[model samples]
Target: MLGQGLVDVFFEDGLNWEADLLEDTRFVMVETTAYFEAYRHVLKGLQEIEEGQFPFEKYIIACENEVSPPKYLRNRRTVQFDLRPLVDENIVIREDEALRRQRRIVNYQFSAESRCAESVEILNLRSWPRPDQLHLDQSQYEALQTALTKEFVVTQGPPGTGKTYVGLKIVKALLHNASIWNSGHQSPMLIVCYTNHALDQFLEGIDSFFKGNIIRVGGRAGEDMAKHSLKVKKQALRKLQDMRQIAGVRFNCTKSMMEVKLEIERSGAQMEASEREILHEDMLRPFMDNCYDQMTCVELPQQQEIPSMMVEWLGLEQMLGETQVAVQQGREDDNLHDKQEDEIALSKRICNASVRLSTVTTKFVNPTIVLTTMPVHESSLLTSSNTTSVECHGQQ
Candidate 1:
């Protein structure tokens, strides 16, 4: 019931539950043909049923281990369990030896009859999702190891080194641990990624592992599934704008809680702006003497000496140069050109440059770099009076 993807269903007619010579009325005797050979739980299971007080035989036929013997160890495991009358809690506990049992579990509440086993016709074990363990390419795997050990991690990266991908993996690791989810902890782990695409990748990874457990705030800023990253950017930007309202207001904004509410009240627009500012400032703290590209090692408490580096060349100075160039070329820096000629030319260049940056970031973002789309950063004017409304979903 837990894992439903790969299922191996075997059907045998005339498996009479009532007609049995194997000597147990409680357990409708299953022939050796029904059992899996090569090494057995069902065999040992039969003995356990006779010794144990509970009528496990009734559940034995109904029981399915999510992962089971030979098939899972070698090939994929896809064993489906067919229950006649659904149980109250359909948790199929898997023995460490096997974990391939499964059930589609549509509506488990409609049945309450005691004679549930009388109706089971066949058994199935399945796993539709290929056994592709979250394959993080070399870089991501490395980052994952580092993130697990470090309390605070900052991967100062350029276009790629799997920054977002690596960050998502850390989330995956946290969620994967049962203790973390059950901890009742607050303060949602913050992930201020580089771009819309990077955020999407993070969300996608999160969804793949956590299902629908997370709540994404700030939508209602754009519409266009094809441009999801762009829309997300607009949503955050709009939130940041709302936050700016609190900038000069007399309200108490020094406290973290107070600032959080103020930003939330302003629709989280300023948060996006702040995130952008962080990335802009990612190059270095202004006027500080340290290079952003290099990461140094800290000494271990027990050792007299220190590890040379936790990470080699963690920072990417190239991002600084590229970002500066792009910012210089941005429409934000251009003069207010009233002439039609200058407007047209400026619009063309901005649009072209945005597109180029979007494309460049796409490849980097996939292998997991954060990136903003062309339209998110700048827009071409269809008309001077254009008042376009980008309405993204999931925002009330």
Candidate 2:
């Protein structure tokens, strides 16, 4: 039985299936949550298409061309892929609702008022680093610029034309302008790749530029990325905070013991209770002060003055920055150790370009800008499917 669902299996020719299953045999099943979500999204998209309510009205497919097969095949035909967009007036696209929905998405995604003209102007006015200093060649620069300014952009390039490189630049630019473009709401960006390796590589690249919260939904991350993973980071931070809390409790316990002693002194033999209580408190003060000095970790400010949760958050933020720096340093060391001469030279070139870019794009690469605007507490990104080109999950 799989969960609550059951199925019956039949053996052929009286074969003993149990005999084939050894005592040490094991079965591993993977969750299909991502696949199921994709499937459900595809069904919704198809339903919308059937109802003539699909978006992207301009790209609707028209008629298909069929041709007979060659002499080698008997009574066979194939559909030619010379497909064209439907432009007939008879085929009307219902776009009013789609437009409204798109507007809402734009507003939420940008955290702005959805002023396209203003946004375009903002993109245009950006003082990008000098083309000569950027790592990208002319074509790459043009592609990156077009992607930044246009509402819809499709970049086509040959294999070695730095598509991924330009993509990383675009991500950086968008993250930098997250607050300015959205005015106040900084929507998270979603990146989808075909394989886990590609995703890990892309995320690692993001980590190089931005030191903020990152939650990787799926698994099979590389060993080097363990500290960067969401689960590991959270656990490490929580463990540190727990230690601090325990220390605080121990210190509080010491104080409480002193208070109990003073109370006992006040309840002394009826003659000199008040004077004894005063003497007891005075004597305990020095020892309590020593205890406070020893338990320095617990000498936190009062909660009313400085909340414990805020302290934990500040500690986490500082650690995250240090972690990113360490990760970057480790990467640099690894490159120095393992890189060939050509790779080392190329890396130097990229570093020079990055330094130049930083002069003009410092605001965009600032971690504070991205973290303050982007709601990391929410589900940041929803990746699409691998098999088909259909957009999958929406913002949660």
**For residues 132-238, could you state the per-residue lDDT of candidate 1 as single tens digits?**
22345655555554454333344657876667656655564454332323333344555554455555556665655453234443333223223334456577779
lDDT of 2 at 70: 22
Model 2 TM-score is: 0.38
**Least accurate stretch of 10 residues (summed lDDT) in model 1?**
122-131
TM-score per candidate, chains pooled: 0.22, 0.38
Report the CA-based lDDT of candidate 1 relative to the real structure: 0.42
Among these predictions, the greatest TM-score belongs to 2
lDDT of 1 at 329: 74
Task: Give model 1 RMSD, 1 decimal.
Answer: 40.5
Error of 1 at 274 (Å): 83
What is candidate 2's lDDT per residue for 1-396, written digit by digit as tens?
Answer: 767665445565589987787766656555574666656666666866754465433343432233222222233242111000011112111213354445532222231222222223323334444344445688887886676554446688788777877787777655544433443344556787778798888888777765555667567887756667778877989999999999999999999999999888755643375454223323344556765344334455464322223234335535655766899999998887776776888988876654211111112343442212222333334333321121223222
lDDT of each: 0.42, 0.52
